[model samples]
Target: MVFRSPYPDVELPDVPLHELLFSDLGERADRVALVDGRTGASLTYGRLAGAVDRLAAALAERGVGKGDVVGILSPNTPYYAVAFHGILRAGATATTVNALYTADEIADQLSDAGAKMLFTVSALLPTAAPGAAGAGVTDVVVLDRADGYPDLAGLLGSTGPVPEVAIDPAEDVAVLPYSSGTTGRAKGVMLTHRNLVANIVQCAPLLEIGPDTRILAVLPFFHIYGMQVLMNNGLRVGATVVTMPRFDLPEFLRVMQDHRTDRVYIAPPLAVALAKHPLVDQYDLSGVRTVFSGAAPLDVDLAAAVARRLGCRVSQGYGMTEMSPVSHAIPDGRDDIPVGTVGVIAPNVECRFVDPATGEDVGVGERGELWCRGPNVMKGYLNNPDATAATLDAEGWLRTGDVAVIDDRGLVTIVDRVKELIKYKGYQVPPAELEALLLTHPGIADAAVVGVRDEEGEEVPKAFVVGQPGGSLDAEAVMAFVAERVAPHKKVRVVEFIDAIPKSAAGKILRKDLRAREAR
Candidate 1:
């Protein structure tokens, strides 16, 4: 039986994302829209909207228009918002690249997304230039001034009218953010303008941000959770977002106190910090009203403990990169929602529990893989029809590889993830990607990666490596090798040397056996 969201459906506007987000900014012209937490700089709604227009005109002047794919590789910054909306306003698709990604890593995404234009910060030119060269991207623009690069500041000087471009909100892809859906290497998730607009409306009831509300954005915009939930949603509701380029607990807490931030969206690791870290007591977090955790599961005990200490309600939501990244969230003003359970489905979402082995729908309270269908669901994975078909059915229901159980009250409690993707502080670390990297080392003979919980009870990637005979490769060597190749979060935190990796007869690595060994 398919379960539908209990909440009433929200009215989805039939327009492009930029129009939907900035339509009524006239009244909110002077309202503070974004605050750079590091520099203490702020951008008003009027300036943000004007920048979007000018940037759109500038990008269009460089021959960017509909069907063009532009890459954005930067941390969460006020200018990131300008570039993001400006690309969409130009009727081009924005493919957000992780700032932490290495040169080769970012190049793979740029090549796959078929990006023609790229925007990045000057600090990242080392990696960005090489990556752009590899991807055959000639138009590399920087958000800041740098030698031999077109700066966004110069573009804003144009003050020319943005060229008019036709867009089909339902058909035209707006953003392409890569993710390892269910399993395997990262593929671009094709999100339409309608998909994003609907998700913002669907998340409206759960996220009660207003003009007066201030949000602390420690989450990166490259990820869907921060892109949609924090940045886009905050702007859609006219809330002030304080952007943090990096996560430093000291800086995070300081910004929350200094800005008097009201709503904070975080991952479980940071939530655990609030619950146990001594530094949290030093800062005044009393102004914070709501704490919502997503990107990974949150422990009920930890959630309750932090809520009691901070005197604010703590909540958790379940989502994936495919579902515009959100399908379930505990709505605001609902005191009865259970602490551990990922609350009721979001508005206009329908979910089914299907037995993984039989591929048949299961009854409520039974354990099965969760299947969701919603307006927020991605159209498909870019350039990968096989994966797209495997995940999204003909009828549009998305097969989420999460094993869950739904109670009579419609609250979802995730039991396990059938997918092999590891969640490291809200970042998706694909084992396959890491395994491929490990094999490149001359000393490494074989490797299998799995997630093991650390002392803080947060999941981190751990590698079981088998070294070439007489090579004398150690754990530190293996960890350092991976750290240099991948993003900081995807680094192998723990390494265990083994003679052989347990595998099934079908040649699949038995991750359960490795997890069992870690548990012991």
Candidate 2:
């Protein structure tokens, strides 16, 4: 028994992503499309469209062609969006790399995605140069020109016409984002042009962002949530987006007050800051009308606190990287959804709750794995057919390893995640990846990683390590060893020395046993 969306199906376009987003920009050409919060810099819609065109022409002149993959490794900036759309305009796939990744990590993803051209900022050249070199990327364009790099300004000087290439929206992959699906190391998730456009259409009604709306984009655009929800959807609706390169609490609030930001899309961590931080009182946030939280479960109390403090509507959504990142969201202007629930299924989405043990659909109000079918779902994982087959089934249903229950009103409340991926402040911290790094330490004999809730009710990665015989390995050393290799969010915050890591007969780490020990 499948549960359908409460909203009517939305009509999706069959054109390329670049076309779908910029086709109607002529009407609002003079409006501010993007703003840099720190520098007070701005980019108008007219300039953005012209920049995209010229950049595409330049990329084509440089030999970027259809089906080629280009990499963008920058934070939220005005040029980031231009580069993103420019790559698509040139009939190429944009593989946005996480700006926080180490050189080795970045190189691994670029190599796996087969990226030929790499675009980055001057500040990240230390890692970006090495990463691009290791990946054998030939063309390197730096937005802020450094020695031995092609300047982005030079790339935009081309007066040549934009490439007029035919695109099959459904079959052509547009963006490749990496995700640790269910359980494994990170693999590239192939999102096609149709997959991205369909999600924007499906979510537009619920978002209802108009020209008057000002979106505060503090979330990193490298993540799927920000890329689709805030950037793409906000642009599709012609809303003004204020981009913050990093999330500084004081600056975030100041930007909202200064820009009169009407909409904010955030994760639970930011929600906590808004609800409890004293600096929130320092700014005039009365202009903020709606707040949409996602990436992790937002506590009911935290949601209420934020709503009460800001005197605005607060809502949460549920999604995964494989689903173009949003399958359920609280409909705009809705006041009926429970505070803790993630709200109704998104438009044009069908979902079911399947009991893993029985392999059957669960009855209403019973917790089970959430399985959804939607046009927003990714085509597959890049170059990993077995992982793709395991995630997306034969019938086109993508099994989201999240345990949830749908109420009688078609509202979904996620109770837990069946997958072992640890979400720390909305960033995915795969335990297996961390454990692999831990084992490389000579002092560590074996290790297992699990997420433990902090005092603020947020998950933090914790590691239990077994030291080598007669080796004196302290908790600090184990924590630092993993922190150096992975991103900050994936860093192990708590380390416990153990005799042996609990494993099943098949030698798989029994994380549940570790979680229970932490609970005790």
Report the C-alpha lDDT of model 2 over 1-520, residue by residue, as the tens digit. Answer: 8999988999888998988888777777999999998888999899998999999999999999798999999989988999999999999999988887889988999999999999999999889989998999978999777988898889999988899989999999999988732255779999999999999998877777888889999888888988989899888888999999877888898889998888998876577568766679999999999998988667676688899999999998888789998899888888888768898899999999998779899978897889999999999999999988998999999998878899888899887667776889998776756765675576766777899999999999999988877888899888878777887888999999989786522133667788879778
- Which runs of model 1 end up more than 4 angstroms from their true locations? 180-182, 420-520
**Residue 5 error, candidate 1, Å:** 0.8
Cα RMSD of predicted structure 2: 10.0
| lDDT to native, each model | 0.87, 0.86
Clashing pairs in 2: none
- Candidate 1 least-lDDT 10 residues: 501-510
As a TM-score, model 1 comes out at: 0.82
Per-residue lDDT of 130-178 in model 1, one digit per residue for the tens?
A: 9999999989999988999999999888766797999999999999999
Best by lDDT: 1
TM-score of each: 0.82, 0.82
- The residue-level lDDT of candidate 1 at 285 comes to 88
Tell me the deviation in Å of residue 72 in model 1. 0.4
